[model samples]
Target: MASRSFKELSFVSIFFSTLATSYLFFPTVFANTHVISIISPLTLVVLDIQGDGFTAMEYVYSTVLFFATSIILFYVGITNFREERLFSEKPLTSRLADFVSAGVSRDHPHLSLFLLAGFTIPFVFMAQMLTLVLFFNIPMPLSLVLLTVSAAFIEEFAKSIGLYAVARERPGFLTPRNLLLAAVAIGSGFLVGEKLLLFATLAQITESIFGSVLFLSLQVLWMPLLLHITGVLITGGFLLLWGRQGYGPGLIAACTVHSLYNLHFLMGALL
Candidate 1:
């Protein structure tokens, strides 16, 4: 009876917690309303200054959007702070890979380079497809993404750096699952930033309630999952190769890939 009552209380707590989360953390409805309310005035401003004005507005809007989007992720991270302990637990010698990853003298530089090329090369193929689409002027946005896709090759390799970093810092976090979690956690932070940008844009641009919700949910799930895994792969690879060589190379590789993905679209805009 006591356990049953406790379970009921837990359920009620979770229900209310989720409801509060929705109320507090949700930006979709508010963002949409704000955009709709402001669009006419914004449009007027845009007509006066045209491209420069629009660009400036975008910067402001993007910043606002990112802030709102990050709020949700921050809330989630705060709630899940206990999960981070997963990185702090475990036996020492079992983390031999972690030490090697942290830069033990016994590691090889070439192995690191090989890790980079391996993760990056597959992404290069994806980028090639993107480049091909761009060259042909395909209707798909894929063309605008070639450069970013190209960088994926390096990004996945860099995920291993997180493992090495945490391992060097704590070592037992070298397991594949924990490594994946770290990537997810870090990537969630990034996606929250992305979610904010998307929200701000949608708030400014669209009004379809069902469509917007679907879009928001999909973006939140898919992009983070893909990105986190990418981090895991690259960083994980480096840890495997260098063990305790530390994560400098892995980090460089991951960031390189990330830069490629975002820059890929940027290149198109410039062209």
Candidate 2:
């Protein structure tokens, strides 16, 4: 009976926490009935000054869409770990807590650490911005190639760095399942950060009329997100297979796969 009550309390706590986080991250979702896109300075630079806007409904939907996707991805990670019985014999709350704890003793990457990995997206974005600014004049084919390589290296390394650090702190974390879950958390974080940044960019630089349309369109798509998750999984898998040697090969392979995926889009954009 006490255990049942404890589990009920845990569920309630998680539910409320999720709601609070949602509001904190996207206060606009609950604030106004209507959302208007005004001409920001970035839009002025990147586009004509047009008064267009995304409705509050659209904004809310887009935000919810990404969060839902992130939740699903994170759940997949937990499910995978559970399939391996990583949390076997533990109470529900203990299992939940262990999954998010950063230490190896818990058998999973820390939840906070996963989120911090996601925040690294901005740093990767800045690097991308620098590459564009400095090398914009490069030939399209060459530039695409450079961008692909650069993006792959930077993103993979950024996403993997946290896992590597934690593993270093606790060598036992190098196990296959733990490594995989770590990658999942990092990838999920990357997706969240990337989507948030893209939305912000669209709001500021792209016209509201176009940005909202694009955001809505993307909400239905999962391929790009899946590719990112897969890339991280591969990187983590390599680390497990090759031990120390896996680091270089894993990074290179991740970058190559990631770049190839982007190259398809680049080719379409150019041609």
TM-score of every candidate: 0.33, 0.54
Error of 2 at 244 (Å): 2.9
Candidate 2, position 42, lDDT: 30
Counting clashing residue pairs in each candidate, in order, gives 33, 1
Per residue, candidate 1 scores C-alpha lDDT tens digits across 1-271 of 1112456558667865764344333332233334332222333344345443445565454344335435633543453344333253334333323333333222433333233223222222222222332223334345434334443443343334334544566555557665555555545543444354445454443344222321222333775457555866676657756776635677667667665545544544456
- 194-236 per-residue lDDT for model 2 (tens digits): 7786676434323332222223223534765676677777777
Where model 1 places Cα greater than 4 Å from the true spot, the runs are: 1-165, 201-220, 244-271
| lDDT on C-alpha atoms for all candidate structures | 0.43, 0.54
Worst 10 residues of 1 by lDDT: 209-218
Q: Which residue pairs overlap in candidate 2's backbone?
A: 37-53
Q: Model 2 off-target regions past 4 Å?
A: 1-110, 202-221
What is the model-wide C-alpha lDDT for candidate 2?
Answer: 0.54
